[model samples]
Target: MTTISALPLLDGTSIPALGLGVYKVDDTTARNSVTTALEAGYRLVDTASFYRNERGVGRALKDSGVLRDDVYVTTKLWNDAHGRGKTRRAFKDSVKRLNTAPDLYLIHWPCPARGLYAETWRALVELRDDGRVRSIGVSNFQRHHLETIIEDSGEVPVLNQIELHPYLQQRELRAFHAEHRIVTQAWSPLGRGAVLADETIVAIAAAHRVSPAQVILRWHLDLGVAVIPKSVTPDRIRANLDVNGFALTPDDHDRIAALDRGARVGSHPDEVK
Candidate 1:
Protein backbone atom coordinates (compact mmCIF):
# COMPACT_ATOMS: atom_id res chain seq x y z
CA MET A 1 0.00 0.00 0.00
CA THR A 2 1.28 3.45 -0.87
CA THR A 3 0.40 5.63 2.09
CA ILE A 4 1.03 9.35 1.87
CA SER A 5 2.18 11.19 4.94
CA ALA A 6 -0.21 12.99 7.29
CA LEU A 7 -0.40 16.59 8.51
CA PRO A 8 -0.80 17.40 12.18
CA LEU A 9 -3.32 20.00 13.27
CA LEU A 10 -3.10 22.43 16.17
CA ASP A 11 -5.27 20.12 18.23
CA GLY A 12 -2.76 17.26 17.96
CA THR A 13 -4.91 15.41 15.44
CA SER A 14 -3.31 14.23 12.21
CA ILE A 15 -5.08 14.05 8.85
CA PRO A 16 -3.87 12.45 5.63
CA ALA A 17 -2.23 15.14 3.53
CA LEU A 18 -3.84 13.86 0.30
CA GLY A 19 -7.47 12.88 -0.04
CA LEU A 20 -10.21 12.19 -2.60
CA GLY A 21 -12.42 15.24 -3.15
CA VAL A 22 -16.07 14.61 -4.06
CA TYR A 23 -17.24 18.05 -5.06
CA LYS A 24 -19.44 17.92 -8.12
CA VAL A 25 -19.79 14.17 -8.30
CA ASP A 26 -23.38 12.95 -7.95
CA ASP A 27 -24.70 10.18 -5.74
CA THR A 28 -24.02 7.22 -7.99
CA THR A 29 -20.67 8.52 -9.21
CA ALA A 30 -19.54 9.66 -5.78
CA ARG A 31 -20.38 6.29 -4.26
CA ASN A 32 -18.49 4.33 -6.89
CA SER A 33 -15.53 6.73 -6.93
CA VAL A 34 -15.21 6.75 -3.16
CA THR A 35 -15.42 2.97 -3.05
CA THR A 36 -12.70 2.72 -5.67
CA ALA A 37 -10.51 5.18 -3.83
CA LEU A 38 -10.82 3.25 -0.55
CA GLU A 39 -10.03 -0.02 -2.27
CA ALA A 40 -7.01 1.70 -3.86
CA GLY A 41 -5.57 2.47 -0.41
CA TYR A 42 -6.84 6.00 0.07
CA ARG A 43 -7.70 6.58 3.74
CA LEU A 44 -8.96 10.12 3.58
CA VAL A 45 -12.25 11.28 2.03
CA ASP A 46 -13.46 14.88 1.71
CA THR A 47 -17.10 15.75 1.13
CA ALA A 48 -19.40 18.56 2.12
CA SER A 49 -23.09 19.29 2.60
CA PHE A 50 -22.90 21.76 -0.26
CA TYR A 51 -21.55 18.98 -2.47
CA ARG A 52 -24.85 17.13 -1.90
CA ASN A 53 -23.23 13.69 -1.91
CA GLU A 54 -22.63 12.80 1.72
CA ARG A 55 -25.17 10.02 1.53
CA GLY A 56 -23.34 8.53 -1.42
CA VAL A 57 -20.01 8.92 0.37
CA GLY A 58 -21.49 7.14 3.36
CA ARG A 59 -22.80 4.33 1.21
CA ALA A 60 -19.36 3.92 -0.34
CA LEU A 61 -17.73 3.84 3.04
CA LYS A 62 -20.05 1.03 4.11
CA ASP A 63 -19.49 -0.77 0.83
CA SER A 64 -15.71 -0.41 0.97
CA GLY A 65 -15.57 -2.44 4.20
CA VAL A 66 -13.27 0.16 5.70
CA LEU A 67 -13.68 0.79 9.38
CA ARG A 68 -15.02 4.19 10.36
CA ASP A 69 -12.02 4.90 12.61
CA ASP A 70 -9.47 3.93 9.97
CA VAL A 71 -10.73 6.45 7.42
CA TYR A 72 -10.47 10.16 8.08
CA VAL A 73 -13.65 11.88 6.89
CA THR A 74 -14.23 15.63 6.59
CA THR A 75 -17.44 17.59 5.91
CA LYS A 76 -18.42 21.26 6.05
CA LEU A 77 -21.31 23.46 7.17
CA TRP A 78 -22.81 25.42 4.32
CA ASN A 79 -23.06 29.25 4.25
CA ASP A 80 -26.77 29.38 5.02
CA ALA A 81 -26.24 27.39 8.21
CA HIS A 82 -23.88 29.85 9.89
CA GLY A 83 -25.70 30.65 13.13
CA ARG A 84 -25.06 28.69 16.34
CA GLY A 85 -28.31 26.71 16.49
CA LYS A 86 -28.45 26.24 12.75
CA THR A 87 -24.85 25.03 12.70
CA ARG A 88 -25.65 22.48 15.38
CA ARG A 89 -28.51 21.09 13.30
CA ALA A 90 -26.35 21.16 10.19
CA PHE A 91 -23.64 19.09 11.87
CA LYS A 92 -26.18 16.51 12.96
CA ASP A 93 -27.62 16.32 9.45
CA SER A 94 -24.17 15.98 7.87
CA VAL A 95 -23.21 13.28 10.33
CA LYS A 96 -26.44 11.44 9.64
CA ARG A 97 -25.78 11.53 5.92
CA LEU A 98 -22.14 10.59 6.24
CA ASN A 99 -23.16 7.75 8.61
CA THR A 100 -20.04 8.39 10.67
CA ALA A 101 -18.49 11.10 12.75
CA PRO A 102 -16.31 13.53 10.87
CA ASP A 103 -12.69 13.68 11.81
CA LEU A 104 -12.57 17.34 10.89
CA TYR A 105 -15.47 19.76 10.42
CA LEU A 106 -15.13 23.04 8.56
CA ILE A 107 -17.09 26.22 7.87
CA HIS A 108 -17.69 26.28 4.11
CA TRP A 109 -17.26 30.07 3.88
CA PRO A 110 -16.90 33.22 5.97
CA CYS A 111 -20.15 34.91 4.84
CA PRO A 112 -19.37 38.15 6.64
CA ALA A 113 -22.44 39.98 5.43
CA ARG A 114 -24.76 37.48 7.10
CA GLY A 115 -22.79 38.12 10.29
CA LEU A 116 -23.45 34.63 11.64
CA TYR A 117 -20.12 32.84 11.14
CA ALA A 118 -18.80 33.98 14.49
CA GLU A 119 -21.69 32.27 16.23
CA THR A 120 -21.21 29.28 13.99
CA TRP A 121 -17.61 29.14 15.13
CA ARG A 122 -18.82 29.01 18.70
CA ALA A 123 -21.11 26.10 17.88
CA LEU A 124 -18.18 24.30 16.22
CA VAL A 125 -16.10 24.93 19.30
CA GLU A 126 -18.88 23.45 21.38
CA LEU A 127 -19.07 20.46 19.07
CA ARG A 128 -15.35 19.90 19.51
CA ASP A 129 -15.78 20.14 23.25
CA ASP A 130 -18.75 17.79 23.11
CA GLY A 131 -16.58 15.18 21.33
CA ARG A 132 -18.74 14.88 18.22
CA VAL A 133 -16.03 16.31 15.96
CA ARG A 134 -12.36 15.59 16.48
CA SER A 135 -11.28 18.94 15.06
CA ILE A 136 -12.80 22.12 13.60
CA GLY A 137 -11.62 24.48 10.87
CA VAL A 138 -12.75 27.04 8.28
CA SER A 139 -12.69 27.19 4.48
CA ASN A 140 -12.05 30.05 2.04
CA PHE A 141 -11.05 32.30 4.90
CA GLN A 142 -8.60 35.13 4.40
CA ARG A 143 -6.22 36.50 7.02
CA HIS A 144 -8.72 39.12 8.11
CA HIS A 145 -11.47 36.55 8.62
CA LEU A 146 -9.14 34.38 10.59
CA GLU A 147 -8.21 37.36 12.74
CA THR A 148 -11.86 38.11 13.36
CA ILE A 149 -12.58 34.56 14.51
CA ILE A 150 -9.57 34.49 16.76
CA GLU A 151 -10.35 37.90 18.20
CA ASP A 152 -14.06 37.28 18.84
CA SER A 153 -13.98 33.72 20.09
CA GLY A 154 -10.46 33.43 21.48
CA GLU A 155 -10.13 30.23 19.45
CA VAL A 156 -8.18 29.42 16.32
CA PRO A 157 -9.45 27.04 13.68
CA VAL A 158 -7.33 23.96 13.13
CA LEU A 159 -7.35 24.25 9.33
CA ASN A 160 -8.30 26.57 6.49
CA GLN A 161 -9.48 25.16 3.17
CA ILE A 162 -8.86 27.48 0.21
CA GLU A 163 -8.59 27.56 -3.58
CA LEU A 164 -4.86 27.19 -3.94
CA HIS A 165 -2.72 26.07 -6.85
CA PRO A 166 0.48 27.19 -8.56
CA TYR A 167 -1.35 30.06 -10.25
CA LEU A 168 -2.74 31.48 -7.00
CA GLN A 169 -0.01 31.02 -4.42
CA GLN A 170 -1.88 32.65 -1.45
CA ARG A 171 1.47 33.16 0.25
CA GLU A 172 0.41 35.70 2.85
CA LEU A 173 -2.66 33.75 3.95
CA ARG A 174 -0.60 30.58 4.09
CA ALA A 175 1.99 32.36 6.21
CA PHE A 176 -0.74 33.49 8.58
CA HIS A 177 -2.01 29.92 8.82
CA ALA A 178 1.48 28.68 9.64
CA GLU A 179 1.95 31.35 12.28
CA HIS A 180 -1.35 30.38 13.89
CA ARG A 181 -0.68 26.62 13.67
CA ILE A 182 -3.54 26.12 11.22
CA VAL A 183 -3.21 23.58 8.44
CA THR A 184 -3.73 24.93 4.90
CA GLN A 185 -6.00 22.63 2.92
CA ALA A 186 -6.06 23.24 -0.83
CA TRP A 187 -9.53 22.63 -2.40
CA SER A 188 -8.84 23.30 -6.06
CA PRO A 189 -5.28 22.08 -5.77
CA LEU A 190 -4.88 21.50 -9.51
CA GLY A 191 -6.51 24.80 -10.38
CA ARG A 192 -9.67 22.91 -11.36
CA GLY A 193 -7.78 21.49 -14.39
CA ALA A 194 -7.20 24.98 -15.79
CA VAL A 195 -3.42 25.10 -15.29
CA LEU A 196 -2.70 21.44 -15.87
CA ALA A 197 -2.31 22.11 -19.60
CA ASP A 198 -0.01 25.06 -19.14
CA GLU A 199 3.33 24.81 -20.90
CA THR A 200 5.29 25.24 -17.69
CA ILE A 201 3.38 22.54 -15.84
CA VAL A 202 3.46 20.31 -18.92
CA ALA A 203 7.23 20.75 -19.24
CA ILE A 204 7.73 19.98 -15.58
CA ALA A 205 5.56 16.91 -15.93
CA ALA A 206 7.52 15.81 -19.00
CA ALA A 207 10.82 16.32 -17.20
CA HIS A 208 9.59 14.23 -14.26
CA ARG A 209 7.96 11.60 -16.48
CA VAL A 210 4.63 12.30 -14.79
CA SER A 211 1.35 13.96 -15.55
CA PRO A 212 0.93 17.72 -15.14
CA ALA A 213 -1.61 17.03 -12.44
CA GLN A 214 0.97 15.00 -10.59
CA VAL A 215 3.52 17.79 -10.85
CA ILE A 216 1.03 20.33 -9.51
CA LEU A 217 0.03 17.98 -6.70
CA ARG A 218 3.71 17.49 -5.90
CA TRP A 219 4.10 21.25 -5.63
CA HIS A 220 1.25 21.32 -3.12
CA LEU A 221 2.83 18.53 -1.08
CA ASP A 222 6.22 20.22 -1.16
CA LEU A 223 4.59 23.39 0.13
CA GLY A 224 3.07 21.36 3.03
CA VAL A 225 -0.55 21.93 1.99
CA ALA A 226 -3.19 19.24 2.31
CA VAL A 227 -4.84 18.69 -1.09
CA ILE A 228 -8.19 17.20 -2.15
CA PRO A 229 -8.38 16.47 -5.90
CA LYS A 230 -11.75 15.18 -7.09
CA SER A 231 -12.14 12.72 -9.95
CA VAL A 232 -14.80 10.29 -11.06
CA THR A 233 -12.41 8.31 -13.25
CA PRO A 234 -10.59 5.48 -11.56
CA ASP A 235 -7.28 6.12 -13.32
CA ARG A 236 -7.27 9.81 -12.54
CA ILE A 237 -8.08 9.16 -8.90
CA ARG A 238 -5.22 6.66 -8.72
CA ALA A 239 -2.85 9.05 -10.47
CA ASN A 240 -3.76 11.83 -8.06
CA LEU A 241 -2.72 9.65 -5.14
CA ASP A 242 0.52 8.48 -6.79
CA VAL A 243 2.42 11.73 -6.20
CA ASN A 244 4.35 10.73 -3.09
CA GLY A 245 7.19 8.93 -4.83
CA PHE A 246 8.73 11.86 -6.73
CA ALA A 247 10.43 15.11 -5.75
CA LEU A 248 10.29 18.46 -7.50
CA THR A 249 13.61 20.27 -7.95
CA PRO A 250 14.24 23.65 -6.32
CA ASP A 251 14.17 25.39 -9.70
CA ASP A 252 11.01 23.59 -10.67
CA HIS A 253 9.41 24.70 -7.45
CA ASP A 254 10.53 28.28 -8.00
CA ARG A 255 9.28 28.23 -11.59
CA ILE A 256 5.85 27.08 -10.51
CA ALA A 257 5.86 29.59 -7.66
CA ALA A 258 6.39 32.33 -10.23
CA LEU A 259 3.10 31.40 -11.93
CA ASP A 260 1.04 33.10 -9.27
CA ARG A 261 -1.41 35.65 -10.73
CA GLY A 262 -3.90 35.69 -7.83
CA ALA A 263 -6.45 34.19 -10.18
CA ARG A 264 -9.45 32.90 -8.25
CA VAL A 265 -12.01 30.69 -9.93
CA GLY A 266 -14.36 30.72 -6.94
CA SER A 267 -16.24 33.49 -5.18
CA HIS A 268 -14.38 35.66 -2.69
CA PRO A 269 -15.36 35.08 0.96
CA ASP A 270 -16.46 38.68 1.50
CA GLU A 271 -18.60 38.61 -1.64
CA VAL A 272 -20.03 35.11 -1.13
CA LYS A 273 -22.42 36.46 1.47
Candidate 2:
Protein backbone atom coordinates (compact mmCIF):
# COMPACT_ATOMS: atom_id res chain seq x y z
CA MET A 1 0.00 0.00 0.00
CA THR A 2 1.23 3.46 -0.81
CA THR A 3 1.61 5.95 2.00
CA ILE A 4 -0.35 8.87 0.63
CA SER A 5 0.35 12.20 2.34
CA ALA A 6 -1.95 15.00 3.42
CA LEU A 7 -2.10 18.71 2.68
CA PRO A 8 -3.40 21.30 5.13
CA LEU A 9 -6.18 23.64 4.13
CA LEU A 10 -6.52 27.31 5.04
CA ASP A 11 -8.96 26.36 7.81
CA GLY A 12 -6.44 24.08 9.54
CA THR A 13 -8.12 20.90 8.30
CA SER A 14 -6.11 18.43 6.23
CA ILE A 15 -7.10 16.29 3.21
CA PRO A 16 -5.42 13.28 1.69
CA ALA A 17 -3.32 14.31 -1.31
CA LEU A 18 -4.47 11.26 -3.27
CA GLY A 19 -8.09 10.08 -3.44
CA LEU A 20 -10.59 7.90 -5.29
CA GLY A 21 -13.07 9.68 -7.55
CA VAL A 22 -16.42 8.01 -8.42
CA TYR A 23 -17.65 9.97 -11.40
CA LYS A 24 -19.70 7.82 -13.83
CA VAL A 25 -19.67 4.57 -11.91
CA ASP A 26 -23.02 3.20 -10.79
CA ASP A 27 -23.92 2.73 -7.14
CA THR A 28 -23.05 -0.97 -7.08
CA THR A 29 -19.75 -0.39 -8.82
CA ALA A 30 -19.07 2.62 -6.66
CA ARG A 31 -19.63 0.66 -3.49
CA ASN A 32 -17.27 -2.08 -4.56
CA SER A 33 -14.75 0.41 -5.90
CA VAL A 34 -14.64 2.31 -2.62
CA THR A 35 -14.19 -0.94 -0.77
CA THR A 36 -11.33 -1.92 -3.07
CA ALA A 37 -9.70 1.50 -2.78
CA LEU A 38 -9.89 1.53 1.01
CA GLU A 39 -8.35 -1.92 1.13
CA ALA A 40 -5.59 -0.50 -1.07
CA GLY A 41 -5.01 2.38 1.42
CA TYR A 42 -6.94 5.29 -0.02
CA ARG A 43 -8.21 7.60 2.71
CA LEU A 44 -10.01 10.18 0.63
CA VAL A 45 -13.11 9.54 -1.51
CA ASP A 46 -14.64 12.24 -3.73
CA THR A 47 -18.30 12.03 -4.74
CA ALA A 48 -21.10 14.44 -5.59
CA SER A 49 -24.84 14.52 -6.06
CA PHE A 50 -24.04 14.88 -9.74
CA TYR A 51 -22.39 11.47 -9.51
CA ARG A 52 -25.55 9.98 -7.94
CA ASN A 53 -23.68 7.33 -5.95
CA GLU A 54 -23.18 8.85 -2.51
CA ARG A 55 -25.09 5.99 -0.90
CA GLY A 56 -22.75 3.45 -2.43
CA VAL A 57 -19.74 5.46 -1.23
CA GLY A 58 -21.26 5.71 2.21
CA ARG A 59 -22.03 2.02 2.32
CA ALA A 60 -18.50 1.06 1.32
CA LEU A 61 -17.06 3.23 4.06
CA LYS A 62 -19.34 1.62 6.60
CA ASP A 63 -18.71 -1.95 5.46
CA SER A 64 -14.98 -1.55 4.90
CA GLY A 65 -14.56 -1.47 8.71
CA VAL A 66 -12.53 1.73 8.40
CA LEU A 67 -13.40 4.25 11.07
CA ARG A 68 -15.42 7.12 9.66
CA ASP A 69 -12.97 9.65 11.06
CA ASP A 70 -10.04 7.98 9.33
CA VAL A 71 -11.47 8.48 5.85
CA TYR A 72 -12.13 11.88 4.30
CA VAL A 73 -15.32 11.83 2.21
CA THR A 74 -16.15 14.86 0.04
CA THR A 75 -19.35 15.61 -1.87
CA LYS A 76 -20.75 18.64 -3.71
CA LEU A 77 -24.05 20.45 -4.00
CA TRP A 78 -25.35 20.41 -7.57
CA ASN A 79 -25.74 23.56 -9.68
CA ASP A 80 -29.55 23.59 -9.66
CA ALA A 81 -29.44 23.83 -5.90
CA HIS A 82 -27.93 27.32 -5.84
CA GLY A 83 -30.36 29.31 -3.69
CA ARG A 84 -30.34 29.56 0.08
CA GLY A 85 -33.19 27.15 0.73
CA LYS A 86 -32.41 24.90 -2.21
CA THR A 87 -28.85 24.62 -1.11
CA ARG A 88 -29.95 23.59 2.36
CA ARG A 89 -32.32 20.97 0.99
CA ALA A 90 -29.73 19.70 -1.40
CA PHE A 91 -27.20 19.31 1.40
CA LYS A 92 -29.70 17.54 3.59
CA ASP A 93 -30.51 15.19 0.73
CA SER A 94 -26.82 14.55 0.17
CA VAL A 95 -26.37 13.76 3.83
CA LYS A 96 -29.33 11.42 3.74
CA ARG A 97 -27.96 9.61 0.71
CA LEU A 98 -24.47 9.55 2.17
CA ASN A 99 -25.84 8.16 5.45
CA THR A 100 -23.26 10.21 7.34
CA ALA A 101 -21.96 13.73 7.40
CA PRO A 102 -19.43 14.45 4.68
CA ASP A 103 -15.99 15.44 5.92
CA LEU A 104 -15.93 18.19 3.31
CA TYR A 105 -18.72 19.82 1.34
CA LEU A 106 -18.21 21.86 -1.84
CA ILE A 107 -20.20 24.09 -4.14
CA HIS A 108 -20.05 22.13 -7.39
CA TRP A 109 -19.75 25.08 -9.74
CA PRO A 110 -19.88 28.87 -9.94
CA CYS A 111 -22.92 28.72 -12.25
CA PRO A 112 -22.28 32.40 -13.01
CA ALA A 113 -25.45 32.86 -15.03
CA ARG A 114 -27.59 32.05 -11.98
CA GLY A 115 -26.10 34.85 -9.89
CA LEU A 116 -26.75 32.64 -6.88
CA TYR A 117 -23.43 30.93 -6.01
CA ALA A 118 -22.75 33.63 -3.41
CA GLU A 119 -25.97 32.71 -1.66
CA THR A 120 -25.12 29.04 -2.06
CA TRP A 121 -21.73 29.68 -0.52
CA ARG A 122 -23.42 31.40 2.43
CA ALA A 123 -25.44 28.24 3.04
CA LEU A 124 -22.22 26.19 3.07
CA VAL A 125 -20.88 28.66 5.63
CA GLU A 126 -23.90 28.01 7.81
CA LEU A 127 -23.36 24.25 7.48
CA ARG A 128 -19.78 24.63 8.63
CA ASP A 129 -20.91 26.80 11.51
CA ASP A 130 -23.39 24.10 12.47
CA GLY A 131 -20.50 21.64 12.65
CA ARG A 132 -22.19 19.39 10.10
CA VAL A 133 -19.14 19.53 7.86
CA ARG A 134 -15.50 19.71 8.93
CA SER A 135 -14.60 21.95 5.95
CA ILE A 136 -16.29 23.67 3.01
CA GLY A 137 -15.03 24.59 -0.46
CA VAL A 138 -15.96 24.99 -4.12
CA SER A 139 -15.50 23.09 -7.41
CA ASN A 140 -14.65 24.60 -10.79
CA PHE A 141 -14.68 28.13 -9.40
CA GLN A 142 -12.47 30.73 -11.06
CA ARG A 143 -10.63 33.50 -9.26
CA HIS A 144 -13.42 36.06 -9.59
CA HIS A 145 -16.00 33.63 -8.24
CA LEU A 146 -13.75 32.80 -5.31
CA GLU A 147 -13.25 36.51 -4.66
CA THR A 148 -17.00 37.07 -4.60
CA ILE A 149 -17.57 34.39 -2.00
CA ILE A 150 -14.69 35.50 0.20
CA GLU A 151 -15.83 39.11 -0.13
CA ASP A 152 -19.40 38.23 0.79
CA SER A 153 -18.70 35.83 3.66
CA GLY A 154 -15.23 36.87 4.75
CA GLU A 155 -14.31 33.19 4.62
CA VAL A 156 -11.92 31.56 2.21
CA PRO A 157 -12.75 28.11 0.90
CA VAL A 158 -10.78 25.14 2.20
CA LEU A 159 -10.08 24.02 -1.40
CA ASN A 160 -11.21 24.20 -4.99
CA GLN A 161 -11.88 21.00 -6.98
CA ILE A 162 -11.18 21.55 -10.65
CA GLU A 163 -10.42 19.72 -13.90
CA LEU A 164 -6.64 19.82 -13.72
CA HIS A 165 -4.09 17.60 -15.48
CA PRO A 166 -0.85 17.77 -17.48
CA TYR A 167 -3.00 19.47 -20.10
CA LEU A 168 -5.07 22.44 -18.86
CA GLN A 169 -2.65 23.02 -15.98
CA GLN A 170 -4.52 26.15 -14.75
CA ARG A 171 -1.24 27.76 -13.78
CA GLU A 172 -2.77 31.16 -12.98
CA LEU A 173 -5.58 29.66 -10.88
CA ARG A 174 -3.11 27.48 -9.01
CA ALA A 175 -1.00 30.57 -8.30
CA PHE A 176 -4.12 32.32 -6.99
CA HIS A 177 -4.90 29.33 -4.78
CA ALA A 178 -1.36 29.26 -3.45
CA GLU A 179 -1.60 32.98 -2.65
CA HIS A 180 -4.86 32.45 -0.73
CA ARG A 181 -3.69 29.29 1.01
CA ILE A 182 -6.53 27.26 -0.48
CA VAL A 183 -5.85 23.68 -1.51
CA THR A 184 -6.33 22.81 -5.18
CA GLN A 185 -7.85 19.36 -5.86
CA ALA A 186 -7.74 17.95 -9.36
CA TRP A 187 -10.78 15.99 -10.54
CA SER A 188 -9.58 14.49 -13.80
CA PRO A 189 -5.98 14.45 -12.70
CA LEU A 190 -5.04 12.08 -15.53
CA GLY A 191 -6.75 14.08 -18.30
CA ARG A 192 -9.27 11.23 -18.67
CA GLY A 193 -6.60 8.79 -19.97
CA ALA A 194 -5.49 11.22 -22.65
CA VAL A 195 -2.14 11.77 -21.00
CA LEU A 196 -1.56 8.11 -20.25
CA ALA A 197 -0.34 7.56 -23.82
CA ASP A 198 1.76 10.72 -24.06
CA GLU A 199 5.28 9.93 -25.26
CA THR A 200 6.94 11.92 -22.50
CA ILE A 201 4.89 10.34 -19.71
CA VAL A 202 5.34 6.87 -21.19
CA ALA A 203 9.08 7.39 -21.37
CA ILE A 204 9.25 8.53 -17.78
CA ALA A 205 7.26 5.49 -16.68
CA ALA A 206 9.63 3.22 -18.60
CA ALA A 207 12.62 4.86 -16.95
CA HIS A 208 11.08 4.39 -13.50
CA ARG A 209 9.72 0.87 -14.21
CA VAL A 210 6.21 2.18 -13.32
CA SER A 211 3.00 2.77 -15.22
CA PRO A 212 2.45 6.02 -17.09
CA ALA A 213 -0.53 6.76 -14.83
CA GLN A 214 1.73 6.52 -11.81
CA VAL A 215 4.07 9.09 -13.33
CA ILE A 216 1.18 11.50 -13.91
CA LEU A 217 -0.17 11.02 -10.40
CA ARG A 218 3.26 11.56 -8.94
CA TRP A 219 3.61 14.70 -11.00
CA HIS A 220 0.47 16.13 -9.37
CA LEU A 221 1.70 15.20 -5.90
CA ASP A 222 5.12 16.67 -6.63
CA LEU A 223 3.37 19.95 -7.39
CA GLY A 224 1.70 19.82 -3.91
CA VAL A 225 -1.80 19.53 -5.36
CA ALA A 226 -4.45 16.94 -4.44
CA VAL A 227 -5.64 14.45 -7.08
CA ILE A 228 -8.65 12.11 -7.33
CA PRO A 229 -8.25 9.65 -10.21
CA LYS A 230 -11.32 7.58 -11.02
CA SER A 231 -11.23 3.88 -11.91
CA VAL A 232 -13.39 0.92 -10.92
CA THR A 233 -10.93 -1.71 -12.10
CA PRO A 234 -9.14 -3.17 -9.09
CA ASP A 235 -5.65 -3.32 -10.62
CA ARG A 236 -5.70 0.26 -11.86
CA ILE A 237 -7.11 1.45 -8.55
CA ARG A 238 -4.27 -0.23 -6.72
CA ALA A 239 -1.70 1.00 -9.22
CA ASN A 240 -2.93 4.56 -8.89
CA LEU A 241 -2.34 4.48 -5.14
CA ASP A 242 1.03 2.79 -5.62
CA VAL A 243 2.76 6.03 -6.63
CA ASN A 244 4.42 6.80 -3.29
CA GLY A 245 7.36 4.46 -3.86
CA PHE A 246 9.16 6.56 -6.50
CA ALA A 247 10.14 10.17 -7.19
CA LEU A 248 10.24 11.82 -10.60
CA THR A 249 13.52 13.21 -11.88
CA PRO A 250 13.84 16.94 -12.58
CA ASP A 251 14.45 16.31 -16.27
CA ASP A 252 11.38 14.03 -16.49
CA HIS A 253 9.29 16.61 -14.63
CA ASP A 254 10.32 19.29 -17.10
CA ARG A 255 9.43 17.09 -20.05
CA ILE A 256 5.97 16.36 -18.64
CA ALA A 257 5.50 20.08 -17.89
CA ALA A 258 6.09 20.79 -21.56
CA LEU A 259 3.03 18.66 -22.40
CA ASP A 260 0.67 21.38 -21.14
CA ARG A 261 -1.31 22.71 -24.09
CA GLY A 262 -4.32 24.28 -22.36
CA ALA A 263 -6.44 21.25 -23.24
CA ARG A 264 -9.55 20.28 -21.27
CA VAL A 265 -11.56 17.05 -21.46
CA GLY A 266 -14.35 18.57 -19.39
CA SER A 267 -16.37 21.77 -19.41
CA HIS A 268 -14.78 25.17 -18.89
CA PRO A 269 -15.47 26.53 -15.43
CA ASP A 270 -16.79 29.86 -16.70
CA GLU A 271 -19.31 28.20 -19.03
CA VAL A 272 -20.49 25.39 -16.73
CA LYS A 273 -23.80 26.99 -16.01
Count clashing residue pairs per candidate: 0, 0
The models' CA-based lDDT, in order, is 0.92, 0.93
Model 1 compared with the native: what TM-score?
A: 0.98
Clash number for candidate 2: 0
Candidate 2 segments exceeding 4 Å error: none
RMSD, every candidate, angstroms = 0.8, 0.8
Off by over 4 Å in 1: none
Error of 2 at 215 (Å): 0.2
Per residue, candidate 1 scores C-alpha lDDT tens digits across 180-199 of: 99999999888888999999
Per-candidate TM-scores read 0.98, 0.99
TM-score of 2: 0.99
